[model samples]
Target: KSAVSRVLSGKPTTTPKKKPGSPSKLDERTKRRIVRYMQANIGVTAPSVVASLQLGVSPQTLRRFLNAEGASYASLKTSPPLSDAHKASRVRFAKYHLDNHTDFSTTEWFQGQGVTTTEWPSLSPDLNPIENIWAYLVKQVYGPDKPNITCKAQLRSRLWHAWETMPKAVIGNCVGSMTRRLTQ
Candidate 1:
């Protein structure tokens, strides 16, 4: 009698009923098309892409989709002019690297340090693979799908994400290429 009563009792099933149809506003085909468009035009902003493609999706939706696919947007900004102190620090760093690592043909000794005095260029982004890494970092941080960074905090967060996610092989390749670049 108890089993019969329990069976007769009106109760919802333990398993939730599945909802029919997709939750996404755009279909898979449309999304794929948008991705293709983005791949071709890397520097194009998301808003411009939406406008051009006529995807009929909101900017926020597009951004979310693109971000999910590892795309972000960032504007090019000019670096601030280097201060005298910053310049001096750069010089010191360069001097340290040159002194510790570089092999000079001349047997000149400076301040008993066995280091030759060499003029380090003020800026040498071409010779440094770190610059390439920085460029890669910037691209990764500001993906084609991501929104433009509006504040320092956002920039820092994105930068951290890029740094953490960057592959060791990429860094090694950049460093490896340095010798070839130096020779050229």
Candidate 2:
């Protein structure tokens, strides 16, 4: 019968939804463990995740999952200057977090040597070519796409891979253009 006839007959118009193809790879317990570990260690890395948790997945897979969970690090876009009230709140926060919890003997030593800290304009030192290495690694570590990474040693190996794999012309061009850029 036509759909108009079915409507006139008062039959249901829609079909039932299909079941999912399969269950998720990670069960509830595993999901909770991952979330707890990340919370406990604010700076958890991908290599560490695979090594410590033995999740049997690749680092790339974990990274994609974490990104889906909205746990990926964000790139900075803009920030306003702090007002005096904000500065005072920051001072209070430093006092609570630092004096109470931090071992700042190094800070004290600097103070004793009269190496006083001063406010400076913001700087993004990522312009240096070497900084590219760190940016690449950060994407691998914090970006969390893989799952089988065994240890920090894997991270070190990847570092060497990056260093070895970069094209020569990129570095050569940077160096070669420096003089011309400075002359301008």
Candidate 3:
């Protein structure tokens, strides 16, 4: 065997070769199109979006992409439709947090790897399926064609009612999805 490079010493190490794999089905242009469509039709379901876009990709694939983009698709009742200014403000807030929260050392030290932060935020929300349960509870609190929430007391009462009355099956399904989510 030949001598190995003294990586422990001051000698520089060679860069690792790229991993071989099939390219992604969705290119940048196609992905941008899908995002724009989903934004415009925010209320549409993932399977419906897959059908509408006819992108030859499964709903799961599209959902994975959206998750990576920091978009929430949880079935929650909207407070009100956001205006352009509200949307812009939200974007700015997200960007500011991203800029401030990212660990500079990870970027400086690592190359050709995925985004790294101080915390493993990528394994959040989805991994913990209680997020879906929370969305369901919010929807249950408001109900269909319900009056707008007026005060903190009223909201609290409705929230309590929803939680107490939530179907056991709904809660069970959300919890059960954890294994499936982990596989993905």
Q: Please name the candidate that would achieve the greatest TM-score relative to the true structure.
A: 1
Runs with alpha carbons beyond 4 Å of true place in candidate 1: 1-112, 120-125
Candidate 2 global lDDT: 0.71
lDDT of each: 0.81, 0.71, 0.81
Q: Is candidate 1 or candidate 2 better by lDDT?
A: 1
Q: After superposition, how far is residue 86 of candidate 1 from its true place, in Å?
A: 29
Better of 1 and 3 by TM-score: 1
Ranking by TM-score: 1, 3, 2
Model 3: per-residue Cα lDDT over 86-163, one tens digit each: 999999988756856566576666644665544555535457678888999878878787788999999999999888
Off by over 4 Å in 3: 1-125
Candidate 1 per-residue lDDT, tens place, 11-101, comes to 5336687889668887999999998897887677878988998988888889899889887677756588899999999999886666554
Better of 1 and 2 by TM-score: 1
Pairs that collide, model 3: none
TM-scores, one per candidate:
0.37, 0.31, 0.34
